[model samples]
Target chain A: MIRLENVTKVYEGGTIAANDVSLDIPKGEFMFLVGPSGSGKSTLIRLMLRDEPVTRGKIWVAGKDITTLPKWKIPYLRRSVGTVFQDYKLLPNKTVAENVGFALEVLGRPRSVIAPQVAQVLELVGLADKAKRYPRQLSGGEQQRVSVARAFVNRPPIMLCDEPTGNLDPKTSVGIMRLLDRINRTGTTIVMATHDHAIVDAMQRRVIALDEGKVMRDDALGTYEGLGEEE
Target chain B: MSRILFLIREAFVSLRRNLLIVAGAILAVFISLTLAFGALVVNEILRINTLAWQQGVHVIAFLNDAGENGVPSNAHEVLLEDVRGWDEVDQARYVSKAEAWIEYQELFAGQEELLDIDPTILPASIRIELVDIALHNSVKFRLDQQTQVVRQVTTAADSIEQLQNLSRVLNVLGLGLAVALGLSAIVLIANTIRLAIYARREEVAIMKLVGASNWFIRVPVLLEGMIEGVAGATLAVFTVWLGSTSLARAGEGFALFRLDVGQDWFLSWGLLFLAFGAVAGIVGSLMGLSRYLRDADGTGPDTPAGF
Candidate 1:
């Protein structure tokens, strides 16, 4: 579960990335964050990850007030919430398996513990056969799958995806979404920021839309709307 | 323990990734430390030689041969007494004409021609030795004031003084040069580590996102720098040891003093240089990595293309 109340993020030189945004999602919800460019979608994800500090208001993640969390404990906060980026963020030099196992490795998990968990997640993302392939050797979809596998490797209670399928083709995007949906079925809460309308409309999950910096709509089983205004 | 291995392996990988820069860093450390240690060793050797020379003949103030009884007069004895009473004079012995004759006869025993010469020509003098060699000038100046009895002051004190001054200058300049070179090496190493980290920026970012402790990401880089430092220092110590050993052996070929220093002295310096190298490497890497660690915006791609 995650909760944000009246959170605001302002960048240097007075650029308001997020303004007066608040939301709450219960456990095991697969929600899509839909928005136009510069609409605070990614900002919201960053706040949840504590990558960017909230300028105003509070944020609570998994029953802990993360906004007040000390800097030393930021890593602990991140360990509890897995993040998947749009670009896949895989090391080009590492093989798919190493990339996935990296999450557990950072957690100081032993190789004996990391090996089986990495294999299971890679199997779940359908990249079991390509575990040895480097990021450059993999397709766009495969790279994204590696990213997903890495995020789910530690089996965190929550996952944040910032446009997980932004760089993939429609068919590939669909596969990535299905992988996320499968992960969600395991009762892991997922909050994804995306602009893929086709996938958004098809999945019909909860959607939170933002505009300029404020939350515009929060609908269960919502449809993709350009401005997210009720007609 | 496994994590430590992972960190070490990662460090080596980083070092290999930027081999040229790392080599340059090591070379910088080597050259600077070599110069520093060589200068310090040379300074120590010169100081030892000066002290040896200072111990034997400090100051010799000759009395006028025109004194009555072809020996020292009351003025000569007075000068000797004045020289001996001074705090700087550790021991002052008056070698009378008779003693000088005996000493001269002993000095030229095999040379009949020099032995036939007059004993009166050998001036009775006060041989003044100082407690501290540095006070030689003051002692000589005070002795020279007795011009009526004192004929001339024979001392290599001026030469020794000049050598001491040169040694002091050499020490200051050598230490200054060493410090400057050491600092430049530190900067070069820090830059090299910075480049290495930048090359793996994305990986670091990913690590940060996964809740990796900053130390987990940084320890390997620090280790990389330390390894380079230790390796360079080892090479430098070996070079200095080889050079000193050769120089000491060569010193045996000549009649001059030996170049050999105490084994403990050499070992202590070697250890100090090694410790310095290790500390410099760790510090430089830490300084370089500090910028990245302080960044709260994880190193991930911040390109807000969409969403």
Candidate 2:
């Protein structure tokens, strides 16, 4: 679960990324953040991750206030929250299994423990047979799947997705969305920021719309466009 | 622990992957440390030679002449006893005409032309070794005050001073060169670590996101830099030892009595160089990591460089 109390983020050039945003996201809920570019969606995700300090107010993730957390504690916070980027930030030199295993390995997990977990995650992502292949050898969809496996390998309580399917084809994006939906059904909270109107409308999930660094709408079971809009 | 082993393995793999850059860093350390080792050896050699010259005959007072039967006169013997009794004089040996002749021959053994002179023509002198080279002036004054049986008083003070001054300048020059070169070695190491960091920036970013501590990312790079330093220091020590002994043997003591830096002396200096190389490697790593680590820690610009 996550809570933001009037969180505000202002960049160096007098540009406000998030303006007095307040929201509550419960556990096991799938939410889509629909907005145009520079609409504070990515900034909100960053604040939750503690990537940058909140310029104002506080943020609570997984029942802890993170706005005042020290920089040294940021990594520990990241361990409990999985993140997937649009670019599938995989190490090009690493194999699919190693990429998945990296999440556990970096946290100082034992090799014996990591091997089985990596295998299970790869199977979940339907890439068990391609474990030995490097990132460049995988297709766009498969690469994103590998990234998804990496993020989900540790099975954190919450997953933050920032345009994960932005680069994938529509059919592949649906498959990836389905995988995320399965993850969310397993009682893991997911907050996906995206511009994919079709996917957002199809999911029929809770939706928050932002414009000009402020939340414009919050709807339960909302369409890609808000409830007041004419399709 | 397995974690330490894992870090060390990472370091080794990185070094192997960047073989050329690692070698470059090692070579930098090697060249700098070699010069530093050579400077230390040269300083020791100079100290030994200077001490020998100062401790050798600091003053020589010549007697009036030889007796009719190739023996120093009794008055000359009395003068020798007087000089020996002086507090400034450590030991005054009465060199007879025959002893002087023999010393002259030994000094120029291979020079047949210089040894062709008559034995009696060599001056019979009193060779005075002083407790300190500075006491030479007092002894010279005492000899000069006496007119009997003292033809001339020659003090080796000026030549000793010259040698001391030359040694001081050479010591400073060698050490200065070593220091400048040592700094260059540190900079080269810093650059090498920077390149290594650049090559793995993406991996570093992922590692940070996955909750890897800052040290988990830093220690392996630090070890890699340190290994380069140690490797260079090893080569420097071996080369310095080899070069020193070879030069000493080649010179055949080089017309000096104090080419006598022993193995123990060289070993101690070599150990110092090794320690210095390790410290320098660490300093270079710190220098290289400062900017990147700061950026990674969220203290930099709007865009995060990497963790």
Candidate 3:
């Protein structure tokens, strides 16, 4: 459902972020993107999110050439791909329920639909009891769960997690990974970018490793490779 | 229905959370509208007073006596008849020398010593009222040409001219002050809205990421600014009304100045002030939202969106 045909991204002043990298993931597939800092992993995710344009390649997500999509239609394209961030990205002033309901609200869904949908998603993420609490009032794991609930609230076809558990403890990271796996098993594609070896080793899913703005390895049920200690 | 209500509820919640900024916006609108309303009231009073003076204007033409100028008494009568027949003249009454002197004596009745002078020394004057006070110059020119009967023409034209000049100067000064105050108010309101938006920047950013439409984000901020503006304007109008009423009451006996703060003026000014409030609110919201939208589009946080 996602394809990058020799996609290249170059920042201003001639800095190449991703150099002629190409990849493909079939529908309902689960994949991990592994790389060190400044290794172009984030750039790949940003390109997928349409936050930045590709320099000299085409990106097709859910069978639409997003490279040729009009600016006004970018938001609608984003509605089909849910994104979770490392910081949880929950609005600090809003309650857990508000943060989760925000995604549905953006879709202009009626309250009757939003309320039940948000309730169900929050329940799935085990954050139903903390719905009334603000982000500052919740722990890191709980806040991450709220973010997960928000990302999945609209039932997007694909979920992109950019270091979703980077700030959590190992046990909490495992829990988030398990939640993601549960979501993946329900027939939705999942693509995560991270450098965590333990989690990648535990998942035993397809992995794509990048080094110096180039894709170094791609394997099904692969192990973390080509990154030394202090990554 | 519930979604709209939820949006409104969220807007109010955000407003309450950012009360200090909202208060600042209200204060800016209040001060600006107060100055504007006060100027409007003063302008209205000046206009009414000018109209009254214009309507009450009369010209008095003094006739040359037959003993001094060797003009026949019949010449003076014929001149009076000619002046009376002018189309511009609304009404004319001939004042005999004795009658003019008697009127002067009555005016200075408290000073009996000055009233002993000869009444015959006063000149016979013809008082003329013009149908239109603005045609004073034309009537004056016509009377000045008749030197055989009229020695000199005196009119309220000079006084009216001076008053008009003063009113024009006052209007320019008021406009300058209003413009300066309006700019200051815009700056103050923009700052207030900026602060409110800054406080909620995280929520705004999240909304953008979630694909919220521009209107969904802008409407709340606009409503907040509008509420503050309307409240401030209403208070300002009330204050000005009370001030005008009190001033009119205090000056009733003294007659230093008179103001007609009647229902019409109140209604008109009140509506104008309300409109000012709405404009201030809309401007503030636009300023705030422009920056927010720009930042959401991946530019610097303070970049303004092109409207």
Top TM-score: which candidate number? 2
Per-model clash counts, in order, read 0, 0, 0
Q: Report the C-alpha lDDT of model 1 over B137-162, residue by residue, as the tens digit.
A: 88788767767777788777778778
Q: Report the candidate with higher TM-score, 1 versus 3.
A: 3
B237-302 in candidate 3: lDDT tens per residue?
A: 888898888887877885535686677879986987687687778787789678877666444432
Candidate 2 ranges beyond 4 A from true positions: A226-231, B66-72, B108-116, B257-261, B303-307
Better of 1 and 2 by lDDT: 2
* Residues A1-231, model 1: lDDT tens digits: 999998988775677878888899999999998888788898889889988777798999999999888878888989889889988889877789988887887788898998999988888888899999999998899999999998899999999999889899999999999999999999999999987788889999999988888888899999787564422
Query: Mind giving the per-residue lDDT tens digits that candidate 2 earns over B1-307?
Result: 6577778887887888788888888888898788877777888888888877877888988876756444445878778788888888789888888899988988999999998998877778889999878777888988988666677899888899899899889889877877887787788778877776777777777777667778888888889888888889889989989998888788785676556588888878788888888877877877776667666655568752111
Error of 3 at A104 (Å): 1.4
Pairs clashing in candidate 3? Answer: none
If candidate 3 were superposed on the true structure by all CA atoms, what would the RMSD be?
4.0
True contacts kept of 3: 0.29
Fnat across every predicted model, in order: 0.60, 0.40, 0.29
Least accurate 10 contiguous residues by lDDT in model 2 chain B: B298-307
- Model 2, span A1-231: residue lDDT tens: 999999888887778888999999999999988788777788888788887788899899999999888878888899899999888989787789988987887777888889999999999999999999999999999999998999899999999998889899999999999999999998999999988888999999999998767889999998777433311
> What is the C-alpha lDDT profile of model 3 across A49-162, one tens digit per residue?
776778889999999998888767767877788888888988888899988998888787888899899989999999888889999998999999998888899989988888
